[model samples]
Target: MILDVILDALLDTAKLIPFLFLTYLVMEYLEHKTKNKSKQIMQKSGHFGPLIGGVAGAFPQCGFSAAAASLYSGGVISAGTLLAIFLSTSDEMLPIFISESVAAGTILRILGLKVVLGAVSGSAIDVLWRFGGKKRREREEHNHIHREHHEKDIHDLCESEHCHCENGSIIKSAFLHTLQITVFIFLISLVIGFCVELVGSDKIGYFISTKPVVGVFLAALVGLIPNCASSVVITQLYLTGILGAGQMMAGLLVGAGVGILVLCRTNKGVKENLGLIGILYGTGVFWGILIEMLGIVL
Candidate 1:
């Protein structure tokens, strides 16, 4: 049984790769489009630029981190905007939407939630930044860096130093990144599937699926631990009727919410606004309960 569980975990992880790859492609395209727009807008007002920046950042699946990284390195966005987008966006939604047996209504609802959450969270960040009144210092620091970079560029003339490449290069990079990411996701999913089967959702999911209130709380907490594979199992249980939609969404919300917090801490040029995270989590639970109530009404 132990050996079987281990094998299952390995396979599930492998299964996640294809999905991750596909998400990478979509994210890359969104990233390019967003960057171009943000560049134009940031030229006008740096603070207002994050509104669009957060929305754009939310579209990509796996590459939000990479996109966020690149944007930060380029000094294109503020930490608040990056955090808002990270909290609002999720790559896992694509596969879930495409998967057979998953409800179209549920997928659409989740997608809609993504947009709302991204905008709301981003706006909150902007408000906080306004009150903090630290933008002047940040902008001055940014200008100094920009000036230094320009000066250095004039002094150090190296033809080979041009790191920015053509569209073809970006596309190729995105494609390869997607391919590797997809393969990795596929493996993770496959292993997760096997492990859930071995442990039986009834044994695990059952305990957590009770007490709507506590269930929702635990679902989010459990999602905090590493392992994307477990999400597959948790989501499957929900779809299969072993768990309720509310429970499933609760798990997803926690996973995405806490996941963003964790990433924000580890990542540079990113800091999450706690108020925004709370709203996202609260909204998730609200939606989850709404779905449950709908079942009774229908």
Candidate 2:
């Protein structure tokens, strides 16, 4: 069993590494080329900001989440856009699923649903906030100023040489990041596979598939963990048939890589971060239940 698990993980890793490396390389190159233009593009996206953010966030990397947080802090992007990025961010799941040989149709369906959910939820939040009266806006404005000053302080503390990465080669950075993620994924996959073997697929499925409401709640909470580890766990479970489509959706939707952590670190106060967490959790659970009701099976 141990040997089988190890071999399976190695095979999956082999399938993913090339794609992962190439994707990151392209992303890094694009980011380096468009760093300045991105801010202007995001600013001008306006009402379509959430859609644009959601699409960009679909890339299987946490870097976009951090970038989105920075843009939000700098007031270059709206709260809606930031949330959209958070909602749509899948961390390493996309690459893992593709590597696992999951059906392309299913992958597309899941991706489409996530992007739609992100756009709709983000737009709704923005609309609701608009009519939420002046007091909240005033407080938010105060927080924004504080966030800027706090960011400035952090920037001042860092040496100028360390602050800029313009001279760094995107290919080198992409290769490093890809290698890091691949190692992490392989380790997690081996552990998860071994555990699944011990626990039995039916037993695990019974836990999550029997009571979807509780499953979704638990899965969403797990997804809130601020690392790619959560994504690995969720994806492994789903691929093993331990989690149903609804449960998988709930967990993956809420698993926004390090987006929440970035929000907490960059935002002015705890209240805002807490609220965003609540929003993400609530949205994930709601959609999970809705999908369950629709009887969408993976």
For candidate 2, the TM-score is 0.65
TM-score of each: 0.51, 0.65
Q: Which residue runs does candidate 1 get wrong by more than 4 Å?
A: 1-60, 69-75, 133-204, 242-246, 257-298
Q: List the candidate 2 regions with Cα displacement exceeding 4 Å.
A: 1-44, 133-210
Per-residue lDDT of 118-192 in model 2, one digit per residue for the tens?
988888877765566356557879887443323222222112214233456877765664565567656766775
Top candidate, metric TM-score: 2
- The 10-residue segment of model 2 with minimum total lDDT is 152-161
Q: After TM-score superposition, what is the CA distance of residue 132 in candidate 2 from its true location, in Å?
A: 2.4
Candidate 2's C-alpha lDDT?
0.70
Candidate 1 deviation (Cα RMSD): 8.3
Which 10 consecutive residues of model 1 have the lowest summed lDDT? 151-160
Superposed by TM-score, candidate 1 places the C-alpha of residue 231 at a distance from the truth, in angstroms, of 3.6
lDDT for every model? 0.50, 0.70
